[model samples]
Target chain A: MDEFASIHHWTGARQSAEWQQRRGVVLGIGDDTAIVDVGLAEEGVAAPKRMLLAVDTMVETVHFNDATMREEDIGYKALAANVSDIAAMGGVPLHALVSVSVPRAWGPERMRRLYDGLYACAERYGVAVIGGDTTSSPEHLVIAVTVTGTVEAALALRRSSAMPGDAVFVTGAVGMAAAGLHALLAQRVDGAAEAAHPIIVQAHRRPAPSVRAGRLLAAHGLGCHALNDVSDGLASEAWEIAEASGVRVVLHETELPRSGSMAAYASETGMDPLEWMLYGGEDYALLGTIDKTSVIAALELFRKEGIPFFLIGEIEAGDAAVELVRARAAGVSHSGKQEKRVQLAKRGYNHFKR
Target chain B: MDEFASIHHWTGARQSAEWQQRRGVVLGIGDDTAIVDVGLAEEGVAAPKRMLLAVDTMVETVHFNDATMREEDIGYKALAANVSDIAAMGGVPLHALVSVSVPRAWGPERMRRLYDGLYACAERYGVAVIGGDTTSSPEHLVIAVTVTGTVEAALALRRSSAMPGDAVFVTGAVGMAAAGLHALLAQRVDGAAEAAHPIIVQAHRRPAPSVRAGRLLAAHGLGCHALNDVSDGLASEAWEIAEASGVRVVLHETELPRSGSMAAYASETGMDPLEWMLYGGEDYALLGTIDKTSVIAALELFRKEGIPFFLIGEIEAGDAAVELVRARAAGVSHSGKQEKRVQLAKRGYNHFKR
Candidate 1:
């Protein structure tokens, strides 16, 4: 079974029982993060601070190998993945518990470097590594991080809140990390590629989560509706929003954000940049829908804050689906220069199916 | 380095940083659970609710093998371990996030059985399986569970609260799980062992956490102090309490609780039951110290509530150490029936060294 199917099976069982009667659980199972009502508020204040729970795990060969990730990068990316999940819900990360299963052969220095990466990321994000479990693994190394953060109850973002005519936007560029991964896999980082595309490799190694942009979006609660982190590529994330919100998402291919380094890497490698943008994962950019009327204001605010914000798509009234509009090459179609609308399939990283 | 040493290394770094300045964190590392003040209160109430965070991980081959643990049992014990951690802090478990890295060869049915075990334990403890991350492992299956619980801010238990002149106590029998594990390892469950000592095998398979007893102790806040769950054997946990509270812990060897089945199994195998009681881990029983004046009252309360309470030891005014007093054989000592004091070393399951 696929990840979603397995999750649905478990969630279905939970819903069928008295488990659903739990108190203070605002959102569970199907979101980027689970929202729990911590219920603490300033006296006379209306909104309670809700706790956002997010967990992400990285396996050695699956997520990173020796060639792709160093010890510190593995630790940094594992924690950053969870932080991005919290950011998707517009939460400020507070505490994290990091559980690691290290191989027996790893010495003190390697383990220390791994923790150094974890501490570095934790310090950068203002998160305290509160408590965790450490065990010895016989084979591959596995790191699972769980983060708890707080968000205003009402302003917390949800993927199901997207409405028709909402303007979907993404923070920063997408596909840079994917291109970086390709570069690493091809071992093209020797001299020329490494000098020209250092940002791509850095992007792959340590992609920053858009916490500030998420906070800004959350602060503009009236303008932002649905938010998600692009971990499973743009197409897959768009499908998630479409499925969760029950709205059609239409993306303009030419408007999809791409970095110069990513474009250059793709061109030099004879790879399609659009393929990386659509199918490659681990971009760690925030994707969300903004109210159409407030889209201009939101863009202006993001610009003022110096956060990269790109309007990439629009939500339309239709059945749950994601479509991409690509400009046909000149005279390629019978109708000259027509926009060819293609259905985007839910195809990205599936841990089971892969 | 040993587990404690590694943990100290990390915790020392956290202590020296500005990260410790985080507000609302009542406790950090070096505890069974981290306590964060949620700050929500009933109108005009003095104490706020504190959230307890605990995480535990069980790695395949290290913690279990096919001969010892079934798929369902693996899932159950993994979650139960985290639940026990929460209970050690006198907290009520409310939610859990499970992260599992299953071997790729495992079928869907195996995965389903694993979830069944997780759901059963969660349902039994009133914990919602809110969120998790599932990935494929190339070799060993690793399950990490993180649980969030709630306790009254004033009554949350910690290991650093034991004082001189306190009476030490433990709930239920110790070392039953060790005997059970031995029975499983010996493959003695075919006919006589399975029929005569079924409880032993079950003990190892499904060790229950003392949640109710923990809640009772928390309720009797004036009497209880320095609570811990026996995850890494009695001797190791005693050392933890002694080190954390800066008091010497003294226990009588004859006073350590043992089940009849454990004794029988030990006799059958020509093994010392005391050895298992001292160093065999995974008992998951509540161990703590109570005020000397309130020990009688506490015992009476436990008796009235039908909970097994054993007065096994006492806290003494001394440096951090753990000692065991054993009566010398009648003819062996120079003086007849003299008590022999032996220092108990911190020699339980050390993940790193072992």
Candidate 2:
């Protein structure tokens, strides 16, 4: 690892020129600092538009275990989390900086594998590895990634933009990643039990961010209002939108999307699938409200793009609050008792709250 | 620690509406992402100039021990390290995003103290705390901060611009921070040893980045050919400039900046003060080379600002290398023998290496 010398090794001349597509970047990496030529415009045009910035961190044990998670998956998910942030803003991710703390037990091979995963994920999303800091930890591994992207001021979406009568929409299914994580944690390091849960395992280990779908919504500017990626579960994200938009979000539990594996796991484990769908986090799906008038256009756009767009709820005129109606048939209790409709509590995985 | 909730409590709306000087910021914190209007200029004006971006990370034990380092000092140093990068690029830091991984043992009170330190350091330089990610860790405290700043395209300095005949200039003395850390680790947490070694300890725990000095050099365009903050000691940083700029840097041992405390500490410990001057790290002083013709202007500029400007070396024609000279009077050897001039090896604090 010392042969790497410093953080610059990954960001320096050794970095492949594959992700260097943005024309405004003057200097990408390999210096005491990185210089970005932001705000550039053609002659007679106004100054450069604002850039989107966000950062996310993944910790060992708190986020994942090396024993259950592959080395590359950790790197991929660490980077994907930040990419998802950029996508949530309806912007194109351009550059990134990663800071990693490596434990001594993880040898260079593991570090290389970890980086392999990171670079692979970066390449897929066209994000240049601009700069970063690397250091050794006496114990545990940690990664923090900062992503920067560009957005036209008028087109940028926010969580506060949703208004009354807006149709709440989500891209793709939710809760699969959480279920995958649960399956992994329940199984021993042995492969037999994991084989029974390949779908959840893959879903958990390598959640694909809806980057294309987000770009489509952002570019269309067609009725998309508030936008957010579902990292803290469907209910929690709906609550964020509801809180930021100063409106109420009412979701019919029957409309919550569930995968076949999730249903199977629910039946076999006697667990309520809706609970995972509503409260389990890290789905990386886009959740927001669109204008009811533009619902057809939005659905057509998503359909043409070959991505699922689920109409899960709607925005209403009320005090900023999130309301979930658990329908009578939503599920039976784990004890096999029929459940009554209820107001769902706002709770998601807040790893920091331990 | 759930009371702390997320990293946002520290970087959130509770954040004093301070440091909001930049005008083109479309959004800052409390959103899906932060949006900065880069390159904003008036009508008919050319595009806004470039923005500099950099990230730095500090880990527990590898960077500091909780027992010896105060909670606030840890937070301050974490943010300061990134600010130094902005300064090195000759940019005015405008905003920052911090990601912190906290261990439960540190507790909520310590976390609050850390944020207080971080915000205090940022506010002093007019840097806005825009956004951040906070999460729990199994062990160790970790901080990663990304700072973004603005610099005129022409004024931004690079690490690779030192040409032959350039006079190397450093702002203020170097190596005090390292000495301060040594004293702290050697003594108890009680204030006695720290009080006895005030300059060094403060230098170590709260090293200030020479933001104004860097801006002055870059803004004045005063023939400052290359610039970098001295974080990894003079020798290592000099090597970075030489290697990047493709020049030979020669330093006169006697001319190296030395404080009275450093000299006294060296004498009492039977160690060479030159070691600390050449190899001690984290001083956060600006080091660079200027055109020989501009020495007086540079000196006058620094004097007017009441900051120290020292000329300790020169760049010369040769393969990229850093050469240090030590005559017989350099120091008395342990056997009382006089030492000859030698080319010092390139070594400094690289925490990533095991």
In the order shown, the candidates' DockQ scores are 0.56, 0.21
TM-score of 1: 0.94
Which stretches of model 2 miss by more than 4 angstroms? Answer: A1-48, A189-194, A329-341, A350-354, B1-48, B327-340, B350-354
lDDT by residue (B1-354, candidate 2, tens digit) is 111122222223421233232333333432111224344455466444566778888888888885457888988888888888888878777667778887878666677678778867866776655557777778889999998877665677888889999999889787687777667766765775578888888888898988898889986659999888898889888888888789999887777888888677667767767777788888989889999999999899889999989998899988989987674566765777674445666776653231
Comparing to the true complex, what docking class would candidate 1 get? medium
Model 1 C-alpha lDDT per residue in residues B55-173, reported as the tens digit of each score:
99998888988777788888889899999998899889888898988887667778788888888888788888788998889998999999999887789989999999999999989
lDDT of 2: 0.74
Judge candidate 1 at residue A126 and give its lDDT.
Answer: 79
Which number leads on lDDT?
Answer: 1
What lDDT score is found at residue B336 in candidate 2?
77
Residue A60 lDDT in candidate 1: 85
Chain A TM value for model 1 = 0.92
- How do all models score by TM-score? 0.94, 0.84
lDDT of 2 at A241: 80
